[model samples]
Target: MDADTLRAILDAQAMQQQKAFDAQAMQRQMRHQKTLDAVMERMERMFSAMGATPAGAPASTAEFVTNSLSTRLPEFTYDPDSGCRFDVWYNRYEDIIANDGSTLDDAAKARLIVSKLDAATYARFTNHILPKKTFDVSLDETVKILKELFGHNTSVFARRYAYLRTQRNDETIRDYTGLVNRHREMAEFNDVTPEQMKCLVWICGLANPEDADIRVRDLRKMENNPQTTLKELSAEIQQFVDTRCQALRKPAIINTVWYVSQRRPHWAKDCDFANKTCHDCKRVGHKKGYCKNFTSKKKPIPKQKRRSANNVVTARPKLLPPLVSLKSANNTEINVRGHFNCNFNIDGHEGRGNCHEADTTSLLGLDWIAQDEPLFRRLTKGAICNVSASKLNTLRTSLTKQLQKQFVTVFAPGLGRCVKSKAHLALKPDAKPVFGKARPVPYAALPRISQEIDRLVAADVLSPIDHSDWAAPIVVVQKISPTLRRLLYWTERRTQATPAPTSNA
Candidate 1:
């Protein structure tokens, strides 16, 4: 045979085989199609009888019931009008059944359900299904009957209202959010209700609206970002609540005024006082707030000596000076490091002020403050304080007082005179009396000199005569006392020097 004819023969056989296979497949498909149609029709009728749609088709959504499981639940103890969510309990019941480790048939399950029902429930179920037995119903139909009979059909509007009204109620934000979501589920709030909407709902239902500023601030935060998710909102709000709880638990400084008010009669109405007496006032009606003998006043700042150093120990200021670069008259920039409130004792005067920190030398510029402000007073005696006369005088005066106290007779007041012996002036024979003319005394010096002469004469230390051949000029010097400048009498007359010993005899 020719190659082309052989090929044609082979093609024809292959085509015939393919057609046969196609026909066989079509016959099998037709047979299976008939069976599927019958099964579907039967299922449709069964679903129709059961008042439900088949799982393959969309049916009216069944309402769910909720039950309070405040305690652990027992078997099949369902109450129809319990106003609780039934789907969750049903799932839990299914779990319980699944964990039973036994394959229970439809009749067995139905009978078990009927047997588990209370007497009242069993009677009610029998009456509801009168003229028919529970065992005769399919397992699915029995479950459906129990659902409709013992479960509450939650109203969409009512569930939504409850979701909207859900509040924190002192519950944690997580718990509050869960409660709201559960209600939203019952309300059939699908994903069409965005998370943003749920977040707004959560914010609106904050338990204590007037508790703090956090809620108002959080609302403002959400206003700026309308796309905030429930997770973000919950997380932020939870963090804020945690911070507030921590602050509340932290110890606070005792405010005396608040403390006193707490014990006040008007404030302490809740406290029992009939059998008690106040130790402060020793009166029954007396209140702690009105007591005048409280010793718990704020501690007074201790007095401290003034220091010349720029840095000092002080409290941190609540409001600090802004970091400003200061300029001197020469335009030298001075960067401020920090600022604080300080208590200062400058020149023996106490003052409180806000001080700035800088590396440059500190200056109490009169330009900064008003001159007439009369800050700290100046030194009373400003005669070169560098001498430290008062400090040395203190030591000398203390010692002098001690010596006078110890030897009262040896250290006499005014002037000291020797009663045991007298010194005789020994002069050379050629020594001559040199008298000097009296110099003119200024008006200021004249009063001081006359006062000194009168004091000396009163003490009998010097004798003043109306006429005197011997005379000398006196020098006037200012005294340290404030009363008057005492003058010192100085005579420059030459005197003979002769060594004379004290007569021990």
Candidate 2:
């Protein structure tokens, strides 16, 4: 009983009669799949009560390409820097349109899948299915929108962890059991690996260490054969892997001893590979990874001191912590290494501080991080950009109308008035007239600062003075604008801080 154990017992009785004809064809397809799932749930509730408009008014994919046959659908060139992977060129373009003996319809294969794609994926499929083109779509709605742009698929738990770590390395055993029977339905294996542990992970990937002597004589005769059948342990590991690849493709004759008088004969002069040593040049006659003066020694480069941008890289083993005496506001001696408490994380915001450690930095003071005004506006926030007047849209309207006609009164509107600076009311000996008081304004900014002080008091630049005894109190101060970050409704909130706040661009 030898032709590989009688062809693994006639392929385990033809996989037990194909598992009894697939359990009698799953009991005759469960009564025609429960009457085709109740006639597809009554044709999906009569097309959702007559809605997707499929009545007589529905025939346009250019009336199904009215006649085209002599086998065509081919043109599928790829190149997006062609290292091939768009789902392996869309499954070699659907296996060349299912072995193209063309019955071309679905609008000539949806205009040959958008005229064979690739000019940057047909410019992103004409910006995702155009004002309807490619003769207005079809081939199963353009291969479901080109499998939602470039068909990916992979997942079933990463193809069952790549078929439980597929192993046969230098390929053959019939292309490693034809890539484990084309991923055996991505290793679903009765869902969660139990057809005897998917034949013990395809017989532990043919026991790999370069087939450890075909795992001690052919996978220990099919791992104790509990009625063996990952196709008879892959035909008994392809019959001892074609008898160890035809005994490693033949020609091997090296039992060396031809020595006329070249010494070494007293039982090969103390054997043990003539006293083994050479762990890379310790010299003796080839042993630890055979090294006839093999190279790699390197280690000498250590120069580094040129530092200049106001040089300060002093960290060579200097951690003397608990010291205290400090004194700086013009009192000088503050080299304090003492003050402690610092826990503050920045983006993933945890807080606790009071720190100092200052032997030249690690201070942490910003008045206790500016007393957390929302973590000081999320650490001086500045990355949110649907234009906060990108400095007035990077202005170049003819260089902003040639700098607004060379700064007309400094680009004047209602305010910019400058007469080369001058101001003086330094009253002299016996000075007196002083009555300045009425100020309460901000009722939510009193009607927008009273319409910007009545447009600077109707642009005479202000002249409403009915009482002036050298008047002085005038404080409106409403300056900070860019609409407070555009009226503050900014929502994107992710700060659970494992140090993730990045924008240096």
Best by TM-score: 1
Candidate 2, pairs of clashing residues: 348-497
Best by lDDT: 1
Model 1 per-residue lDDT tens digits across residues 290-394? 455657577755455334222255533565774556787898887777776676655455566667788789866443232323451242235455554658878
Kindly provide the TM-score of model 2 when superposed on the true structure, using C-alpha atoms. Answer: 0.19
Task: Report the Cα lDDT for residue 436, model 2.
Answer: 47
Candidate 2 RMSD to the real structure: 42.2
lDDT of 1 at 187: 60
- Please give, for residues 285-392, the per-residue lDDT of candidate 2 as tens digits: 655664655455976344443443224555333345654666766988867665555567765657775566665645555777776578777777975657566556
